[model samples]
Target: MTVAPRIAIDAMGGDDGLPVMIEGAARALGEDPALRFLLVGDEAALAAALSARPALAAATEIRAAADVIAGSDKPSQAIRRARTSSMGLAIDAVKGGAADAAVSGGNTGALMAMAKLALRTMSGIDRPALAALLPTLGDNDLVMLDLGANTECDANNLVEFAVMGAAYARAVMGLAAPRVRLLNIGVEELKGTDEVRDAAALLRGATDLPLRFDGFIEADRLGRGEADVIVSDGFTGNIALKSVEGTARFITDLLRRAFTSSLRSKAGFVLSRPAFHMLKTHLDPNNHNGAVFLGLNGVVVKSHGGADAGGVANAIGVAAKLVRADIARRIADDLAHFRAGPRTAVAAK
Candidate 1:
């Protein structure tokens, strides 16, 4: 019989700490009887949470550790000082073959640092990028890469990101021959800085890739279903992602206030409850909490710091799917293919 893949969760990492993480782990296990979790954190809190659910208690194995990395701690300093922190322990679990993958909602910088230091990067990958799936106007979700991970990227790095993002989209979104786009100031090839223009030229000449190069994409056209995978520098990608999140929250709050303003509106809200719920689910960050750090040797998922139990559960589900798909291995294979092809001649400025 095939053994079920084990997931290492940082129970003491997120804002809500062990309680919410444990709840999320329990929920995930409840969904799949074969799923096993390795919870890394304070022994007492983890035991208490698991003990509440007898079945989950049996499914989970706890790794007792003392330290907890705070969000405010410096990534380098925290990584060195807190060797036994939940996040560090989770990475160790994956490294030591105790788990197939790991999930964390703690310090982003610290998590990235630990992952790089512990798991390292796949061949030909200059840096591992944080890639997320965003809801788009199209039928399929758009995979955006380098989301707050690498602030400054070069032409080759962007090309590498494009390849990785395309592979992820094809595997996760089930899109054959996924359309790839480079996020830029304008859709034209001549627009943006020398870096983007150079990257666009390189992508255009990458005829060996399975992805369809769709040229440049503007930020405004991101939600309009322009491309299946959007690649950009971390600075731009993070700003765009946060802006969309803030806008989504503002719109939801406004709708809530409007719906509760009067009896008639409240009655309408009751009648439209199903539709409202669907819309909320479509826009909810919790439903899409998992952001994979692509180009790594092993699957490492980073959830939102303020994620709830549902979000954490969804992140775990994402990690499971990634592990089943062998996403890292696939990415490495694709990168190797791209590198083996004739090097594209750099376009003249």
Candidate 2:
């Protein structure tokens, strides 16, 4: 019989605190009956929260953690108290084989640092990257990576990101062979920096991989679903992500103002209410809530700190999907196939 995936949760990590985290878990459990949880937090508080949700309580086991890492804490400082903190313990659960994956809505830097130290990178992976799914104009979502994990990336790192990101796309997006591209200023071969150009050359020459390398894709074409996976350095990826978010909000606010400007506009909005509702739902960040740390020995998903129950549930869902899909193993196999040689190996930092 197949075993159900167990997820460890850092209940006390996010801005909304335990209530939202527990509720999100409950929602996820309700959606996936085979899933189980290890909720890490103060025993008394967790017991109180669990008492209210009998169904979630039934599928969950409370694991006591003595401390909570503050959002403002630095990664260096947070790593020292790794054992006692809720986030640390949750990640430990994964390393210890107690859980299939770990989920947290905590300080990103601290979580990344703790996870890397505890789990380490898989063989053939130099660094673990942060990857997240973004809404696209097409029916499927785009898989973009290095969402702030490593600020800068070398050509080798970008090539690895492409491989890992494509694996992620297959697992989560259910594409057999995802189209891969580098985020470039222009689509032309000569437009990007040396690292990007080098990475492109390497990917183009890479054979026997499951993904299709489509070369460079411009930022504006991202939403058009030109590629299934987009790879870049963390600095560029983070800025581009924030820019898209800001633009989404701007368009949403502009529509709201336009609809409320006068009675005629209000009537038109009412007439087109269904279309607007679809647009709103499509643009909502909660639907695409998880930022996965790829290349780690085990799966780690980072939810937005301010995410509500729905957002948290979505993040948990992403973790569950990856676990079921066996993303890490697939990535390892692909990496071994695509970049096999003495020179491909890099010493871990």
Candidate 3:
């Protein structure tokens, strides 16, 4: 963590293909020139592509991995091919200490399976949660999980998530004591299911923990700046994430239509161009492109397959930041404290 991270890039895993992935690495280097990469994919193709990117080529080493995990491949099937796949080797680089972290735009299920198998969950974590940062109107971005990792979770899982999430916020966002909330039907204590209510009770009693646990938060208030960490089962979290994304797209599209409806509207758009540009930047998925698999022994970031070069660079940046901060050790300490009994655990300053 004291020096620049050496990252392992799954170069053949994205939809836009190798070009965007390579360009993303180059872009990341342009921002932080201390980065180095272990590019895993076809040897000839990688060599040919990097020939055009002199700086990236100079900072990278190619590791030929001939196989690729298809987007349509199931995790069960893909797990068997881990030894030969590009995504697999990238993760392997992290497990083997050849790299500080791994970044891939490959199949999520496959990546999760391979990472869990290779890196294993941390000592106190039962399962690894998929967590990502969402742009909020608050002082800093919000961290939300499980985002489709655990379809169903008990009260224990929920509490564990809150601990992991709060640790993530503190380590990566530099929050001393983040406000944690359960994703529920309403802010009322009794409004959600039994599991949510039980989790809330546990969190409220956990004063010795590092976070400030509120009662509950409704999905509509996700971006309202009310909470710092949001926890939920994967099913609900995934739906809420998609709903937010869809709403952003709908609003942007609606504005596009309205702006072109008449000459006056077009002129109004021209006058309001700067505001619209800011709006676009806020709504763009590329700006929030990295989703980390929390609780693993090593850091592995999941990039959206449809991400452009900018998006991939942002994902790589997320991975690099996590590496530089030693997020894994931070989460492990919190998890260990949680596993030991809250009454015995001391609040983090």
**For model 2, the run of ten residues with the poorest summed lDDT:** 340-349
Q: List the candidate 1 regions with Cα displacement exceeding 4 Å.
A: 1-3, 260-263, 347-349
> For candidate 1, which ten residues in a row score worst on lDDT?
340-349
Across 1-349, the per-residue lDDT of candidate 2 in tens digits comes to: 1158899999998999899999999999989989999999999999998998899999999999999999999999999978999999999999999999999999999999999999999998999999999999887999999899999899989989999999999988889999999999998899889889989888877767899999999899989988999999999999999999999999889989999999999999999999988987898898999999999999999999999999999999999999998888988999988766333433111
Global lDDT scores for all candidate models? 0.87, 0.92, 0.90
Candidate 3 per-residue lDDT, tens place, 1-349, comes to: 6478999999999898788999999999999999999999999999999898899999999999999999999999998988899999999999999999999999999999999999999887878899999999888889999999999998878888898899888877889999999999988777989889988887887776789998799998999888999999888999999999998889888989999999999999999999988988987889999999998999999999999999999999999989987988888777676656554332221
Name every residue pair that clashes in candidate 1.
none
Model 3 worst lDDT window (10 residues): 340-349
Model 1 RMSD vs true structure: 2.1
lDDT of 1 by residue, 16-98 (tens): 88888888888888776778999998898888777788998888899998998999999988779446888998998888889
RMSD of each: 2.1, 2.6, 2.7
